[model samples]
Target chain A: LAKTTQPISMDSYEGQEVNITCSHNNIATNDYITWYQQFPSQGPRFIIQGYKTKVTNEVASLFIPADRKSSTLSLPRVSLSDTAVYYCLVGAGRGSNDYKLSFGAGTTVTVRA
Target chain B: EAGVAQSPRYKIIEKRQSVAFWCNPISGHATLYWYQQILGQGPKLLIQFQNNGVVDDSQLPKDRFSAERLKGVDSTLKIQPAKLEDSAVYLCASSEPQGGGGNTIYFGEGSWLTVV
Candidate 1:
């Protein structure tokens, strides 16, 4: 499993953009970068995933540099409802039998109204 | 599209007692996982099962914790002689068989356990 490091907490106001970066210097070639959002008393929800470059969805965008050592999650027009813990996970492969997706402490984003 | 289902949403037991949690994964999901989440910490994987076979369980405390996925659909995690430190949320998750790119794992609401 590739270890990931991210900020412990971040603060943002409504209509502002929030960016959280995760460092996975030891990420493997077969690994993919994935992010999840977890609200209190609920399960973590998939936000976005990418192997390289950039990928965007209805929820957020993932930006991975060419080195692949780190990745960033960008959220646009934040609202109070977006306040939650964001987890960055590495080491998920394509069709590989090994399923050891590990999570770190996660970055807690507090969106203020 | 039913998502993962877990029962006994909340449980409280005395130390040295026994408790169990049940989980039913989404339809057609071949992989099931059990995770323990402590307050103010990230969830830790306890076990993973592929269909009806065990895939990974290195983090599981075999002396008192055990989980089984029977018929490749539903699973049960049991803890015997629970200790005070066992107070945490037990989460059940499932994902489809990895085919290409990345597989997305889905989680349930989790079962909260308090060992007094």
Candidate 2:
């Protein structure tokens, strides 16, 4: 499994844009980058995922460069509700595309109004 | 659709006691996962199951923890002789694999356990 590195914590004001980056210098070729958001006392929820290039959805966006060594999760118009711990996960591929995931200490985003 | 369901939202047990948590995955989800999340840290995968078969349990403390998915639908995880460090949230998640194994997995609210 590729080890991921993320900032321990980040702070943002309301209506700001928060971008959290993760570095996986040894990410595998078949591995995919995924992000999950977890609020206090709840389970982690899937935010976004990407292999390379940029992927966007209603909630957030994920950007992966050519090297695939790093990725960033961009959240637009942050609010207090956006306060949560964000996890960047690298899922290794098995014989098939399916595989297990292990998470590290995530980046805690504090959105203040 | 109904999301993953879990029972006994919270549990409190003393050291050397036993406790169990139950989970029901979303309809037709083939993969089920058990994760332990200590406060202020990300969740760690304890075990993964695919249709009543164990896919991985490398991180599971088999000496004290065991999980079984019967009929490939509902599952249960039990902890024997719980210790203080075992106090954390036990989460159950399930997913239907998408192409390239990137499908979003849904998690239940979690079973809060406090082992004193």
Index of the highest-lDDT prediction: 1
Pairs that clash in candidate 1: none
Best by DockQ: 1
In terms of docking quality, model 1 is: medium
Residues B13-89, model 2: lDDT tens digits: 99999999999999999899999998877899999998999999999999999999999999999999799999999
Q: Tell me, by TM-score, which candidate is best.
A: 1
TM-score of each prediction: 0.98, 0.96
> Stretches of candidate 2 above 4 Å error?
A93-97
Give me candidate 1's TM-score against the actual structure: 0.98
- The CA lDDT at B97 in model 2 is 68
Residue-wise C-alpha lDDT for candidate 1, range A1-113, written one tens digit per residue: 89999999999999999999999999999898999999998878889989999999998989999999999999999999999999999966686666667989999999988
Give one clash count per candidate, in the order shown.
0, 0
- Shift in Å, residue B60, candidate 2: 1.1
